[model samples]
Target: MTRPAAPSQFDDPWQAQVFALTVALSDAGHFPWTDWAQAFGATLKRHGANRALDGGADYFNAWLETLESLLEQRGLAGQAEARTIRAAWEQAYLSTPHGQPVKLPA
Candidate 1:
């Protein structure tokens, strides 16, 4: 039997945002799609997520890692900056009141 189509919904907005950013950055020529595929595949393998176990859960996590790796490899963003950005997101998510949008620090 044919497999069912994968759902488009993400577990959270952050996952969706990561997915969007991957596409946007790739489109902007940070890396070609072939490079993207290799990075993403390596990330998935590293996470032992090559198989669609747990219903393909953690796919976006790998995507985020791949995005970061690509950005770092392409000299677009430093590792320190990535860590800072992650911390800023965590703080924004924690401090924002429920129902309010999280904002990056200016």
Candidate 2:
């Protein structure tokens, strides 16, 4: 499958995380885009519009942060696990293909 472009430093990390989570989950048949979009919109409202990212990279980063927080809160992962996940994401981000939809490692 085609992968999306890598996010730039100017991009929000949380958004990128959430976007990646959404993509990964959807790819796994766990949730749909509409549901993810609705939840994302609500998250933005609750978290504040300023937290709502503008660019692809920024959005992905925001999403990633959200995912880590949620995972921690849900007791699915610990700080170490989150750190590992973040590191892996960083590596993937650096190596990801530009202008295509790439799958995040599960």
C-alpha RMSD by candidate, in order: 3.2, 10.0
Model 2 Cα lDDT, one tens digit per residue, 1-106:
4444764453455555556665886688655667656656666566566554454554554455555555565575677876887788787887888875655677
TM-score of 2: 0.39
What tens digits encode model 1's per-residue C-alpha lDDT throughout 7-105? 658878989798888888879977788989988888877787445534234888778777877888789997889899989999999999999988997
Give the Å error, residue 84, model 2.
6.1
Against the reference, the lDDT scores of all candidates come to: 0.80, 0.61
TM-score of each: 0.72, 0.39
Which residue pairs show backbone clashes in model 1? none
Native-referenced Cα lDDT, model 2? 0.61
Highest-TM-score candidate: 1
Clashes of 1: 0
